[model samples]
Target: MRSRIVVGVSPSLAGLQALRYAVKVARERGGTVDAVRVWLFRPLWRDTTATFERRVHLAEAELLIPHAFDAAMGGPPTGVKIEPVVLEGLTVQSLVEHAGDDADLLVVGGDRRGSHLLGSGPVTRYSVRHARCPIVVVPPPALAQRQPVDALLRELDREIR
Candidate 1:
């Protein structure tokens, strides 16, 4: 059976790293990746203008998924299938809810700017506690870049073959 991986992404470098990691895992495991981005629309009142603003935010979030994917992987990988999902809700709750029973894995980016604690970000911490499936928290760019490029290339080659 094919694996299903869910990745939570945003515009940040860490978010890019998470998406990249998800793509790599999907390629290696012969799985499909669901790249999900969540946005919250908080309006002062329930008016037409507020509704329009919510729509705008949803559109921007939808666009951000592909933009982040392209920026991270130089366009999606050739073999792996990636489905972009834009959800309206809280970040952690949305991700956890989306990871439902079908997902084999959930991938998310850690907040490097936050305190130096494991799963420091609320989303990461909450996901660790709430996600039903296994969760992979990708380190921020600075930490991830420290790994040698040759190792990553070798892994990529292995996956392709």
Candidate 2:
């Protein structure tokens, strides 16, 4: 059977990396890719009525999947089958449910905000533990890691001078 690769999508750099990786693998394996994004109703979104707010959040999720594809691959990859899934629920749970047991692989972006000691963020960690399929966590490019520290050091030096 052709591989089914499910990858989580977010606005993070690592997220784009994971998406790109998933597309490449799908292309090579003659598989399909499910680019999934999960949306939740946060208590902080009290500015609008519940129903309308939920609709808006859902719409955002829909738009996000395409946006991620556009940003990652200049639009969806040419040869591979791409399915964009937007689910409303907890992030990790939604991803795991959509990926399911039969998926050949589940891919996620590592949490760059996490401390070096902790490795990945909570969602990535939870998915690795709970997901039935094998998982790959794509880390942010090294440039992403260095840019922040370099800026911070430059700022510190300026202050010292």
Candidate 3:
């Protein structure tokens, strides 16, 4: 059972799915979920306008946590503890660094709609290859449901066998 789980969250549907999945796992495993949102702001020059834009971007990134949490788990679960973290850096790098040595699992969402390859976004792809802890990539709900229930069951049974 995972004791500490880290989840990367954004405003996308895939991010919401990852959050939802992380909450469920934490509830079942008696663990805490660390919801991390990474923001990147690159300014060509350091000026008042650039600083103002950075502030605005940071504010928006901070707001995304609560909104995504609410949309995903219907407002953070009362049964599990959630810690929201807002960090400034590249999404994949930030998440990987956050996972560090203590986290037992890192949860992220796959971009099923946009990716033509593995249906995974850049963050998910990078995390899978570089994360220190075990990673769980939750596919978008629509993509998960694309397969018929019977077919899914059969596949599960075969895996079990």
Candidate 4:
């Protein structure tokens, strides 16, 4: 059976890279891609839990969903059907909840900028640790560049072939 890949998209490099790579893998397997965009906004408490704040925050989040969808799926890989889902909550928490059932694989992008020098910390740990399905961590496009050793090895392998 073809794999069903689930990817979480945030407004960051890590999330966007994952979406692109997920589309690529899904095409290879004749699979489907579910791109989830999470809008997390909690009203500040200090008597600011007012009705206006709640409504406006939620509205802002909802509006972002479509824009995020377009950004994530605009040039998706061919033969891979992409579906978008927008969820509101803690990004990691929502993704964990999504893992309860469905989807054979979970794909997420690695943060390109740091908690220590590079990449997102909370996101990486949360995904690799808690996801029920196998998680694929895709690094940024910059990481896609071929290393010298890797290029040499590929050349050798081609000669053997």
Best by TM-score: 2
- Checking candidate 3 for backbone clashes, the offending pairs are none
Candidate 1 differs from the real structure by a C-alpha RMSD in angstroms, to one decimal, of 9.8
- Model 2 regions more than 4 Å off: 43-48, 113-117, 147-161
Tell me, what's the RMSD of every candidate? 9.8, 3.0, 8.3, 9.3
Where is model 2 poorest over a 10-residue stretch in terms of lDDT? 111-120
* Candidate 3: tens digits of C-alpha lDDT, residues 8-118: 987677778889989889988999999998999999999999999999999998899899988886786888888889999999899999998789899988775544436
Overall local distance difference test of candidate 1: 0.87
TM-score of each: 0.83, 0.87, 0.82, 0.68
Give the per-residue lDDT digits (tens) of candidate 2, residues 1-161.
Answer: 89999999998889998999999999999999998999988765565587788898899989998898898878877999998888888997899988889999999988665434267677887887899989888887767766587788999999999
Query: How does candidate 2 score on lDDT?
Result: 0.86
Clash count (model 2, backbone only): 0
Q: Give the Cα error of residue 116 in candidate 1, in Å.
A: 6.0
| Model 3: CA > 4 A from native | 113-119, 143-161
| lDDT, model 2, position 25 | 92
In angstroms, the error of model 4 at 110 is 1.1
